[model samples]
Target: MSTLPLFPAVIIDFLGSATAIALSFLALRYSWSLIRLQPNNFIWGFLFYFCIAMAAFSLSRGVGHIIKILLIFGNRNDIWHLLSPFSGGINTMLMISAAAVTIYYHKGLQAYKAIRSEAEKLSEANTRLSNSAEQLQMLNTHLEEMVEKRTKNLSESEKKFRNFFENSKDIIYFCDNDGDITSINTSGRNLLGLDPGTTKVNFYDLFCHDSDLLKYLDELHHNGFVSDLEMECKGKDGPTRHILLTANAIYNEKGQMIGCEGIGKDMTRLKTITEQLINHEKMASVGQMAAGVAHEINTPLGIILGYTQLLMDDFDENSEDYSNLKVVERQTRACRRIVADLLKFSRQAESFKTSLDINLIIQEVLAVTEHTLNIHGVTVLRKFDQNLPMVFGDSEKLHQVFINLFNNAQYAMVEGGKIIIITSASKEEVVITVMDSGSGIPDAIKNKIFDPFFTTKDVGKGTGLGLSVSYGIIQEHGGTISVKSPVEHPETREPMQGSAFYIRLPATGVANHENEENLYNGGNTGIR
Candidate 1:
C-alpha cells in the first residue's frame, strides 16, 4: 500500500513544480515589459526586479524538486539530500530581495507624489502671476487714458481763460501794490491808450482828478475791494472819460495780497447822453419862459416905438427935444427888436415852407451884404456845387440866416479875411459849410454859444438871439447845424484855421427848374 501512494505523490509533486515555474516566468516577462515602458518609475522597477527574484526562487525550488525525484528514481538519494539545503537557501535569498525591492518602491512612490504636488503648486503660482501681470497692464492703460483726459481738460480751460482775457470788452487790469499796472487785457490797453509793447504804467496817472484816485485807494485799502466806484479818466487822444470801476485784491498761496485786479466799464457815452437830456430839458423850459415874456412885451414895445416916432416928428431937427425924442425912438426900436428876436427864438412866428435853392439863397444874401462885408474889409468866396439839391424851408428865413452868418463873419474878421461858402449834397441831405478865417470860438464857450442870450460880442453889438433863433428855425426845418472851431485843414492854397459852420438840411429834390439857370458854376467865386 505504501509503494502505490508514493507513485501518485511523486507525479503530483512534479506537476505542481512545473506549474509554479511557468507562472513565475510569465510574471517576470510581464514585469520586464512594464519596466521597459517606464524604466525610471520606482514602482515599475521594483515590480520587475521582484518578479525576477520570484522567478529565481521558483526555478531553484522546482529544479531541486525535479532532481530529487530523478535521483530517488535512479537510487541517488544521498546527492538529492545534499542539494536540497542549497536550493532552499537560494529561495530564502530571493524572498529577501523581493521584500527589499517592495520597501524601496514605497519610498520612491512617496518622493514622486511629493514632486508632483510641488509641480502642481508651481503651475498654480505661475497662473496667478500671469493674471496679475494682465491686470497691471490694464491698470496702466487706464491710468494713461485718465492722464490724457485730464491734460485735455486743462488745455481747454487755459484756452477758455485766454479767450475771455483777450476779448472781454470791459477794461480788465492787474496792478501791483504800488499801483503800477503789470498786466492789462486788450480792452484795458485800448481804453488807457497804451501800446502793446508797453509793459508797465502807473494807475494813478490815468485818473483825471487826484481826489478820485485818493478816494479810490482809501476805500480799497479800507475794504479790500471797491465796487462801482465812479471816476473820471483823462484819455491820451480824446475827451475825459467816465468809468465805473470794480476791483479786488489779488492774493498768493500764502494769502498775502500782492496786487489788484480791476474791471472798468466805460460810461462816457452814457454820461454825454444824460447831459444832453438835461440840457434839452433846460432849453425847453427857457423857451417856454421866453415865449410867454415875448408875447407879453411885444405889443407894448411896438406901441412905444410908434409913439416915440410921432414925438420925434413933432420936434425940430436942430432942437434938443428932437434929439431926446430920437433917442427915445431908437431905444424903443431896440427893445422891439429884442422882443422880435425872443419870439423868433421861441419859434412863435408862423413859417411858410418852400422848395428853396440853398445856393441861390446864399447868393442873394451875399449880394445884399456885399457892401457891408467890403466896408469890414472881408472877402467872400463861393464854392457852389452844380445841380445842388433844394431845401424844404422858407426862402426869406433861410435868406435871413445867411445874412446873419455873413454879418457875424464880417464882425469876426476885424482885419481882412476870407469867407468860404461851400455847398455839397449827399443822398440824405444837402450840406452847406460856411467857413471863415477869423478868431476861433473859445472851447469854454463852445457849448454855450447856442443858448439864448449867450453872446461873445460887445453888449450893444449883439442881441445873442441870432444863433439861438437860427437853431430853432433849423430844427423846425428838419435840419442840423454843427460847428467845428479851430477847424483842422489840410495844407492847401489857403490853410485857414478858424470856425466852420456845417448846415445839414434834408433835401427836397433836385434844384428848382427856374433856379437851375442861376446855379453858378461849381468853383470859387470871389466877392468883395
Candidate 2:
C-alpha cells in the first residue's frame, strides 16, 4: 500500500487533539453548570454548555488557520506546501464548523425539550383546573337540585294546608285580634248564605244578638279555647240559625296571642232531636212505672168487676141499679184489658222457643183476626208460599206480632181497605210482607208510629205500645223489618198512596241460623 501523506496525518492528529481538549473543557463546564441546576434540569443544562463550547472552539480554529498562513510563508513554486497546509487548516476549520453546527443542533434540541417540559407542566395544570371546574359545576348542580326539591316540598305542603283549610265540614273562620274575618271556609260561607265570590262578611257582624259577641270573645281570650258555646247566627237570609261554636286562640312560637279560629256547628236540628229523645225517654219511663202500678191494680180490678157482675146478675134485670152496675162492670173490664196491654209493653217476655210451621202459625193468626177484619169491612188477602220451612220462634211473641199488625191495619182502614199478607221464600231467607191500602201512614207521622206512647189515635183508643212491642218481638226473632213506600205512583205518576212493611228471616241451614236462636234467647241484640 502507498504511504499516507504526512501533512494530512498531522492535520488529523491536531484536529483530534483539539477536539479532545475542547470536549474535556466542555464536559467540565457542563458538569459545573449541571451541579447548579435542579436534578430534573441537569441533562438539558449540560447539553447547552456543550453546544456553547463547540461554537467557541469553531471560531478559535478558524482564527488559528489565518495565523498559521501569516507565519508560514513559502516559495511560489512550492504551491503544494502552501496549499497542503491550508487544505489541512481548511479541513480542520470545516470539522470545527461541523462540530459547531452539531452543537447548535443539540442546543436547539435542549431548548425544545425545555419548551416541551413547560408545555407539559401547563397541560397538567390545565387538566387539574378543568377537573376542579367540573367538580365545582357538579356541586353547583347538586345544590340547585336540593333547592328545587325543597321548593317543591314547600309548595305541596302549602297546597295540602289550603285544601284542609277550605274543604272542612264545620263552619271555620279565621279572625284577626280585632275579630274581623280574615279567612272563612266554604262551610262558613254557606252557613251565612254569603256568596263565595262577592260577599265579604265580618265575622262579628254575624252574631244574632250584640250582647253575645263580647262575652264569647272574652271567654275565648280568658280560656284560650271554648267548646260548644251555643248562640244564634244571623244568616244573609231572613231567618237566624242556632249554632254551637267551638273556638281556640292561635298563638305564635313565643306564646303570644296571634289570632282566633272558630268552628261553628249548626245545632238547631240536633237540639230538637235531643229534646225529642229526652221526652221520649221520659215518657217511656213513666209508661213503665204506670204499667207496674196497673199490673198490681189489674188483679184487684178483676176481682171487683167479677163481684160486680155477679151482684148485677143477682139483681132484677129491669132495676136501674142493675143497669148501673152492668155499666160499671163493662168499663172495669175495658180498663183491665188496657192494663194487660200496658204490662205486655212494659215487660219484655222471654221467648218460648218451639219448632213451628210458619204457615200454620200465620193461618191461625188470620183466623183470630177474621172477625175483626169483617167488622172493619176490610178484605184480607193471603199469599202463602207452599212448603215453607219450619222456623223456631216464640209462639206467644209471634202471635203478638200478627195481632198488632192486624189491629194496626184494621185501625188504618177506617174507610175500608184491602190488607195483603204475603210470604215468600228465597235461597237463604224467608220474607213476610204486610201491605195496607188505607190512607197509608201520613209522611209526617210514619217514622214515629213505632215509638212507644207515640200514637195518632184519639186518647184511650190506643195504648200506643202495640207497634213498639211488636217491633221488639220481631227483632228478637232474628228478623229484619223495614218499611217501603213509593213517593210517586207508577200508572198515574202521582204521589204515592200507601206503605208496606217487610219482615225477613234467615232460612234454617244458613250460617245465620244460630244467630236466630241466640236472638230468641233474649240476648241483647243490637238495633236491626
Error (Å) of candidate 1 at residue 292 is: 1.4
Global Cα lDDT for candidate 2: 0.72
Q: After the best TM-score superposition of candidate 2, give how far the Cα of residue 482 lies from its true spot, in angstroms.
A: 8.1
- How does model 2 score by TM-score? 0.48
Alpha-carbon runs more than 4 Å astray in model 1: 1-170, 185-199, 222-224, 490-496, 509-517, 521-528
lDDT of 2 by residue, 195-302 (tens): 868545678888888778877888888999877788888888745778989899999999888889988988867875786677558657866786778768988998
Alpha carbon deviation, residue 306, candidate 1 (Å): 1.5
* Residue-level error in angstroms, candidate 2, position 509: 4.8
Local error of candidate 1 at residue 335 (angstroms): 1.1
- All candidates: TM-score: 0.67, 0.48
Please tell me which predicted candidate would have the highest TM-score against the true structure. Answer: 1
Candidate 1 residues 1-528, lDDT tens each? 455569888999999999899999999999989888988676776777888888888888888889889999999989878988887888788888877877787778889889868888999999999999999889887988888999999999999988998899999888998899988899888887788898778988899888889988987787889989999987667667799999998778998878899999999889877876676677778789989998998888888888888887887999999998888888888888888888877888888997788888887787778777878887778777777777889887787777777777777888978888888888769999888888988877767777878888997999988888787778788888778888755225454567888889999776655664565653345533
CA displacement after TM-score superposition, residue 303 of candidate 2 (Å):
1.9
lDDT of 1 at 259: 82
